[model samples]
Target: MADKSLNKTELVAKIAASTGQSQATVDAVLGGLFDALAESVGSGTKVSIPGWLSVERTSRAARTGRNPQTGATIQIPAGHSVKVSAGSKLKAAAK
Candidate 1:
């Protein structure tokens, strides 16, 4: 399984084969899906697929950190982050 992960081209090919669609179409749909997710999350909205996954924006407080090389203190700025949670169906599939 370690070496069996699919890249974009391979994933698109498989989906296209299974759905009887062209590889270009599958890739296009995937591109659209990622765009939509980014747009929604960027706007502070939670995007959920009931049985698959959920994505949302989260905040982090600014804090102090050390420089890895210099061992000097530094300030880390607060920022927004994207969080993705796998839903029930995804969990069940993993099990």
Candidate 2:
């Protein structure tokens, strides 16, 4: 069985071989897909790919925190984070 870890190059090669498409074409398509996903998620839009994954921008409120090394108190500014969740199909595939 193939290893579970697949980087971009390996994934593109596999997809190209399976679809009988050129590696360049597959790479381009993947690039465009990533670009679109980032653009949407960065703009506070929820992106959902059925049976695959979902991504969204999440906001966190400002809060106080402690410095472990110095044991000092600090303020953590509010910030945004990206949340990615795997869909049902992905979960099943893992098993």
How many clashes in each structure? 0, 0
lDDT of each: 0.96, 0.97
- RMSD score of candidate 1 (Å): 1.4
lDDT of 2 by residue, 2-42 (tens): 66789999999999999999999999999999999989998
**CA shift at 64, candidate 2, in angstroms?**
0.6
Worst 10 residues of 2 by lDDT: 1-10
Residues 1-95 of candidate 1 have per-residue lDDT tens digits of: 45668898999999999999999999999999999999999999999999999999999999999999999999999999989999999999988
Model 1, stretches more than 4 Å misplaced?
Answer: 1-3
Scored by lDDT, model 2 comes in at 0.97
Best by TM-score: 1
Clash pairs for candidate 2: none
Off by over 4 Å in 2: 1-4
Q: For model 1, where is the 10-residue window of minimal lDDT?
A: 1-10
Tell me how candidate 1 scores on lDDT. 0.96
What is the TM-score (0 to 1) of candidate 1? 0.92
